[model samples]
Target: MLYRAPHKTAVDPDTGELFTDLLVIVVPDDSAKSALVEDPSVPFFTVPHFDGYNAVLVQESRLGEISRDELEEILIDAWAARAPKELVAEFFADQ
Candidate 1:
């Protein structure tokens, strides 16, 4: 997969440096088309699309070093953080 710098700027409070080399994978409709980062040592995150089938994967270049469980946790958190609150409310409104 191709690696491009994230256009959005969000400072890492702990590092205090401009994050430059993170990866973002945007899947269209079907998750099958998604791209995977080969490395297993970097931090990773993901955002599931509102429709549920698509998602965006964000991660550091060295995700290979991180444990699978940790990566999954980060991805789930990112997915929750990225989801639109209003949309989520609508989905849960009937419950």
Candidate 2:
């Protein structure tokens, strides 16, 4: 799922961009870890509050680092992580 930050929750260390202008996505734990490790060039970060939940904050300005297909995959995975199993199964079955 994607949501806008109500305040300046996250910031980009390099460019000083804030999360208030971006969208946060809740992903699977493995995916979150993999994104942090495998895609170090991308500025992905999280807060302590998100310790147990698998999520990451990304600056909208930095979205160029990921391709359209990658974004689509992330969105689908995020949705599946939150959606009911039956809905996810039906969604995939349609594909």
Candidate 3:
């Protein structure tokens, strides 16, 4: 399942300011969950549930503040690491 936090923040740079949205993705399976939690690149927080799933957080900032391409690449990398192949394919196929 996918979850999102209500918090939003902005990154400011010489060009302008960029707003970011936070998100959390919960995947089923212990190994995948562990892999995601261990990855240092993505910012994540563990949920309090006893289930094997984990929560991965990501932020979206403006192009001027931080390249949108880079932000999306980070999100995709984390999502692929945590989510099952089928789930990832399905999510992206629709988009």
lDDT of 2: 0.72
Alpha-carbon shift of residue 14 in model 1 (angstroms)? 1.2
| Candidate that scores best on lDDT | 2
Give the CA lDDT, 0 to 100, for residue 64 in model 1: 75
- Worst lDDT run of 10 residues, candidate 2, spans 5-14
What is the overall TM-score of model 2 with all chains considered together?
Answer: 0.72
Report the C-alpha lDDT of model 2 over 60-93, residue by residue, as the tens digit: 7778898888878888988998899999999999
The alpha-carbon lDDT assigned to residue 37 of candidate 2 equals 38
| Model 2: per-residue Cα lDDT at residue 11 | 58
Query: Considering TM-score, which of the candidate structures 1 and 3 is the better prediction for this target?
Result: 3
- Which of 1 and 2 is ahead in TM-score? 2
Each prediction's total of clashing residue pairs, residues at least 3 apart in sequence or on different chains, is 11, 0, 0
lDDT of 1 by residue, 13-85 (tens): 4777645765654433343223332333444344322235344455465667667886565454445445788
List, residue by residue over 1-95, the lDDT tens digit for candidate 3.
34344432323234344323545554445665676557665444353442444444434331234356855664576667767899999988998
